[model samples]
Target chain A: MSYTTDPARIERNWRAITIELDSPRPGRLERMLQRLGLPTDVSRLVVATPALRRSWFVALGLSMLIGLLATDAAKPRDDLFVLLLIAPLVPTLGVAMAYGSNADPAHEVGLATPMSGLRLVLTRAAAVLGFSAAFLALISLLAPSAPAMAFGWLIPSFGLCSATVAAMTFMAPRRAATVAGTLWVLGVLIARGAGDDPLAAFTVVGQVLMAVVAVVGLVVAVQRRDRFDLLAVR
Target chain B: MTNSEIDAVGQADQEDRALVARIARRDRSALEQLYRRHAHWMTPRLESRCGDPDLVDMAIQDTFVSVWKSAKKYRGDGAVGAWLWGIAIRRLIDQMRKKRPTSVDLQAVGGLEHAMAFEDTLIDNGTHGSLGVALRQLDPDLRAVLIATAIDGLTTKEAARLLGVPQGTVKTRLMRARQHLQETLA
Candidate 1:
């Protein structure tokens, strides 16, 4: 009937009541991932094609076609600049379309999986960026500009795509794409208006600035990536 | 309450925080380590509440999966064990809501008897006698909030969300529960 406030005694009783049940068997989580059709191995998860489907590839091809057409239409002096501006949209939009609750149909399932939200977003972003960069590089050979000008869009594309993915962490995918796309277009227009050189935005200074922004944006994205897995706001 | 006890608690907290950080970085081994560390205690506690082994297992699985996804949101302000308990209890509640009436046969499973036995064991122990009796005397509604906020270490808001009640309601019940315990134990 008497009460005791002895901290050690209380701790002992608490520990007594907390019976340690059996730990789950190894590969139990892996089986769950297999049921969900996700990669069982965390290392293989990055290269898994679940995030990028046929629709994304179609979108990529269409975007590349549009870029090539735009480049062919523009004058020879503006060809490389036009390609630089047009090429990044493929990856920026691809990044948006490949992830996010609004973009990926399997988003809820992905969120519920063992893969961290940051890892999911980063993996998809990397795939989209890598695919688009390589595709653009191959297509740039057909552009009538110098080889340096041909690869001019690479840094800016990476920066813009990274920025878009970071933005998607806080907002819906399409909205993030719009905001990133608008900023990119406006930057190109302002640079064109300011100078006679069409490739001013892809200059050494511009490329360096873009690279810095890419790194910062990636850091920010990784920091806030948990927002992606949040239940949709009612 | 001893210095060594405090140090032990602090070390556990640091380890829990580090585990969560690793989980946020997609370290599966860290997740497994955390699961092994806490799942043993969490499983039995959740099973004691829900009284269904299947439901307890599902809740535990879902809790760790959620931890993997949202470990970045853990601010490290409180005990990590409490945070894990909060998630586990809420996941149990969610499963109960989804599978109520038909799936969880409380009477068939002797749920009330189990809970009573749990209470009696705590009250019989001299260390928990007063607190246990006070808790057993409160209405189930009030007791649930008290157990969630006080025993499980969930925030009032988190407790309210888990109980599907307003934050104000949880606070009021908590205050009333405390007053009743004070009066009875006095």
Candidate 2:
């Protein structure tokens, strides 16, 4: 009848719901994650991974530069070795910052959702690993000098990422990542020093050990999964 | 307008701008104040553009929501009312885009004609100056085209379709109306 279409209706509705056209949707990576079947909330959590952000990409780009330059500076045989070592290490930082109040701005809102905290963190960790493996695979494939399969780092990355998540159950995200990453770098260096070849850490025995670490870390993370659900004071 | 009336209007505009600034900082109260004040007048204008009240409600909701999200984008070069209308019209177009109009409907035709008449009455109510006098003096056909494009923020094609005339005819009528208004005001 009248020209005015009840404003109160919208007022009540908007107060009840947000993040439609009203709030900012997560940026492009989140949209990609959504298309891949992660729910909207979970995709948002995945994108908030600090290591997956633009600044981190700049760091990745620098690492790629190092990969490119390492080939030119070192022996012809050492091109893929640098990338193999770097690829598995990338997800370590991402998985570390994937959860925790200090890292995710929407951590509270995400935890409050029906999704369990373990599911949220694990999903984000998997996404981080997938993205890191993909980008690193791209680098290794595109390297001017490399062997047939540059994916040798994939298993090692899983081990270290799993170790980081398992460690997250014990302490802060950054601290967990630091401990796992340090151990990984140290283990690889020690393996290289003790063994004849420098790529000894990527050998069959090393691969088997890393896979075992992955399984054990995941089991431990699951056992302590409830820790992710709690709001730890910073 | 008298000195006091002009001062009151200026203060209201300032208040709206302040609310926009607060909304940029995500103040819910300021957003509510803005929606209440501007949408109070904006709804009737929107209702005149579209026949469906539900569509009107959707558009208003979209406009305010967009304002909240994009408040920081407000340049403040003009009145908040002007900035708001820019968003409102686009949101209305987007909402209308979602639901395609039926190809042939007598109700749609009548609503378009009725809306034109309503616009004429709206112009009549606001005929407070020389511009209004010039607007009132224009032919009804020319006035409808002018209002559709100039006030309702529709494109030439949209105005043509709304008035059921050719796009060239809408353009010619708009130019003629603008030229006439300019001559009258000058």
CA RMSD of all predictions: 16.9, 9.7
Native interface contacts kept by each candidate, as a fraction: 0.00, 0.17
Regions more than 4 Å wrong, model 1: A1-51, A55-63, A66-74, B1-186
Tens-digit lDDT track of model 1 for A13-69: 333323222344435434655666765464244344343455666666676656666
TM-score of each: 0.44, 0.51
lDDT of 2 at B177: 90
Candidate 2 clashing pairs, residues 3+ apart or interchain:
none
DockQ (0 to 1) for model 1: 0.02
- Candidate 2, residue A106: how far the Cα is off, in Å: 18
Per-residue lDDT of candidate 2, residues A73-177 (tens digit): 445446666666667778888887778888888888877877788887788899889887877777776776667546788899999999999998899999999
After superposing candidate 2, which stretches have Cα over 4 Å from the reference? A1-28, A31-74, A81-134, A141-234, B1-4, B101-118, B126-145, B152-186
Pairs that collide in candidate 1 are none
Worst 10 residues of 1 chain B by lDDT: B111-120
